[model samples]
Target: MKLSDAAVKKAKPEAKPYKLADGDGMYIEVMPSGSKYWRLKYRYAGKEKRLALGVYPEVSLKDARERRDAARKLIANGTDPGEAKQAQKREGKIAAANTFEAVAREWVENRSNDWTAGHKALTLRTLEQDAFPSIGRRPIAEISSSEVLATVRAIEKRGALEIAGRVLQRCSAVFRYAIATDRCKNNPAFKMSEALKSPTRSHYNTIEKGGFPKLLRDIDGYQGSPMTTYILQLMALTFTRTGELVNAEWKEIDLDRAEWLIPAERMKMRRPHLVPLSVQAVAVFREAAKLSGDRVHVFPNRNDPSQPASNAIILRALGRMGYTGKMTGHGFRSAASTMLNENKSKWGIHRDTIELQLAHVEKNASRAAYNFAEYLDERRTMMQQWADHLDKLKAGAEVVKLRA
Candidate 1:
């Protein structure tokens, strides 16, 4: 007889285990300990097998019969119900293990060899802060393109258009990795670039060539701290990126060789750069060394000698010289590039040499690997001439064009 709720509820345990048959190979097994379990018995491949539906009261009589019907249907389809149940459990475990965050972390670990420590840390930090909180726990295969769009849009709403774009890019990379590894069939983040807002473009404020002489004179006459004064002079001479200049260490400079060898890790392109120091640059370094020779950083912070001086020091000094928004610390690079390129013929230097001296990335990968020292002799000559030109500008002498 098929089981009923009251009949199963009133059914009590006997001296040992007993079965209340519900027909169709389904029964409620009641033990002597007053515990009831729902069980399904079936034959497959000419062999008897048992499947546990669930515990009694929790599974209920109707629920047990429904499970029995489902299992019988599977058996009629020439499939083993017990094996199908096991396969489903395995799939559940796999899905749980292959969440979006899990796959993304694996991808990052695999590619970390090609990235610097700082780059790896930043990539992970952005994922953790922005991407992980939303779809991180979802299975990579189950995440739809719309879900990924929603996650990226959340970042864009906060006015961080650039970070929003970058997060989308990182997610796309992770999805591609998933596709390669067979975790997912398609990339949800594919072709979604147009959905993000475009970031506004801007350039650093810089002075024109005509104003270069006056600016040089103003820096020379400024009565700032000796360290600030020397730092400005060196900045004008080298035209390096502000971070590279401020974080420079005493060990990187060779006064005897007249070179500053900035290591690869500190450079923006992750390539070592050699600055051929001029006679004037050497003098500026000598004056700075008198103040911070014993310290680790050449431009150590005045308040905290252990740390490098803040980049704002240059801007503040420029502001004092009445060039507030007219120029910036990075203006030095723009000024140098402009002046040198315009006077390329007079300076008798190739445009490529000037670009290399500026530490710009070389397009040819194979050549870039060994071109850090390319055109060294020509760059050394150009640097000395450039320094001399600055001296004439500062001295208020007439600007004389060099003979090629």
Candidate 2:
């Protein structure tokens, strides 16, 4: 028999257990202590299962019966109500465990782990100094666009426009993580661009073909350590980026083969580059091979061989030489490209070959596929002639290749 709501609320304990039936597998079990519970007793797959709702008077007869009817609907539609409740509970546990901050920390940890020593330090420092203080403890989903704008404005106020741009991007990453786990609705950082100020470009001192001869003479005069002098010399001859050249491992260079094999991972293009070496470049690497304690880097910092030199070291060297914006550590490539293209006839180095070695994006499909090594007979002679041009400039001789 169905129990009345008034009777269920006013009834006292009978010092024994009893059941009040609501029909169709729905019933309320009353205990001796006057505690009551809503339950549905049913059979599925030739087995009986009892699905429990909340205890009654707390879960009133009407509400319990309504819940029972909903369960019945689910069962009629080929679903197990008990199994569904358990699945919902499990999902609750996962949602509780994976808070916004928890997921963001996980994302930061994995990315920071794979980074190089320098990059690892930089990323962690940025997050700790700027991100963690504000949103580290706050659940990621709880973070609003205004909160993100606050972090970015803090950077902008300090006159760090580039750094502010980077921080905004990182905050967007946190929002992406929040949305993936059903925490937030969508990314707040997208439309928040209006909060940021306009960007200003800091132009580097780029050397051009017209200024090549004058600059080459100045680079030959950079008064610094034997290591810095040799590094500058190699930078000009090979036209390799200063960072790639400095961080180069001895194993990548084949002095006998007169070639430097830059691996794919180290390169900006993420592809291996075979730099055809001249005799002068090979001599420099051979000289560099003598100094080493344990670090595998060819041109490691003088004080700490375990790491590479700071950008300040090269920049300082440039300052002391009176060649301050005239050329930079990165300008050597421009110097080579300019001189090679200027005297292609005398040097015999093709524009395509020079651009390919420079690692510029060669969109011409046919030209991109041409292998300079396949034409070694022609290339070997050309590489030597190219080295001779630099040697003439380095000797303070009149550089006739200087085009007005």
Candidate 3:
């Protein structure tokens, strides 16, 4: 008999298990505990077999019949209904294991060895903050380009266009990894090359050549902490990125050799950078050493001696010296690049040495390796001359800016 909703609901259990036949090998097995479950009885390979459809009321009489018919169709095609069900269960488990977050995390773990600690932490943080919450659980193979675009657009809506672009890039990298590993057939993020809003380009505020002397003088006469004064002085001499300068360790410097060897992990280019410390720069470090005494970082924070000075320390000092918009912490690098490139003839400095010192990437692999070893002798001379020129400017000497 074909089962009806009321009949299934009213079918009560007895002392022994009973079966309510619903025809076509589909029946409801009523247990002594009053649990009713739908089951299908069919023959496979000339043997009798049973398949559990679902629990009653939840599965419903109508749905159970539909499932039974579907199973019968599978049986007609010489396929075992029980085997097909198990296959789907296996596929579901595999899909769960191949979620976007799962594959992305795997990819990150595989590449973590090549990335700096900060880069790895920031990459994971970005995904956790942006990508993971939205599409992290979705199967990598099932995710579409439109879904990826939507996630990126949500970030764009918050006015973080650059971050949105970066999130898309990270997703693209993960998707590519998935493709290579056979977890995904396509990279959804690949189609989003031009989908995001372009970020605006803004130059860092820098002091003009005419005002460079006063800026140096103000730094020299800074009434801040001893560490702050030396920080400003060292920043001018090395012209490295502010973070690199702040996070510098005493072990990285060799005052006797007049060199500060910043490790590859701390450098923006992920390559060890050699800064030929000038006589004046070395003097500043000597003062810093006395103040830092027994600290790891050359410029440890005054509040917390364990960490480097906060980035705000440098910016705040510049503001106190009355060069708010006139100059910035990063402006030192720009100013150095501009002034050094212009005075190349006067100093006999090569452009390649300046660019390499700036830690800019060389696109050609062979040339990059050659350049890393090249011109160390020239760079040592150039850094000393650069420092001397700054001293001349501070002393109010005639330091002529050469014509381009």
Best by TM-score: 3
Candidate 2 regions exceeding 4 Å error are 1-102, 112-115, 181-183, 203-213, 237-242, 263-280, 287-297, 304-311, 323-404
Candidate 1, 1-404: lDDT as tens digits: 67889999998999999999999999999999999999999999999999999898989999999999999999999999999999999998898779999999998889776554567788999999999899999999999999999999999999988899999999999999999999999999999999889987334688877788899888878898988888788889999988789999999999988999998877776678899999889988999899999999999998999999998999999999999988898889988988899888997999988999998867887676656778999999999888988988777786554432
User: Tens digits of per-residue lDDT for model 3 on 183-275?
Assistant: 989888886869789987434778788999899999999998989999999999999988889999999899999898888888765678888
- Candidate 1 local lDDT, residue 32: 95
Residue pairs with backbone atoms closer than 3 Å in model 1 (clashes): none
What lDDT would candidate 3 get against the real structure?
Answer: 0.88
Please list the residue runs of candidate 3 whose C-alpha ends up more than 4 Å from where it truly belongs after superposition. Answer: 1-43, 46-69, 93-103, 128-157, 168-198, 204-212, 319-328, 368-374, 399-404
- Assess candidate 1 and give its lDDT: 0.89
Q: Per-candidate TM vs. native? A: 0.67, 0.55, 0.75
Instruction: Give the Å shift of residue 104 in candidate 3.
Output: 4.0
Q: What would the TM-score be for candidate 1 when compared with the true structure?
A: 0.67
Clashes of each: 0, 1, 0
Which candidate number would show the highest lDDT if scored against the true structure?
1
Off by more than 4 A, model 1: 1-200, 209-214, 315-326, 393-396, 399-404
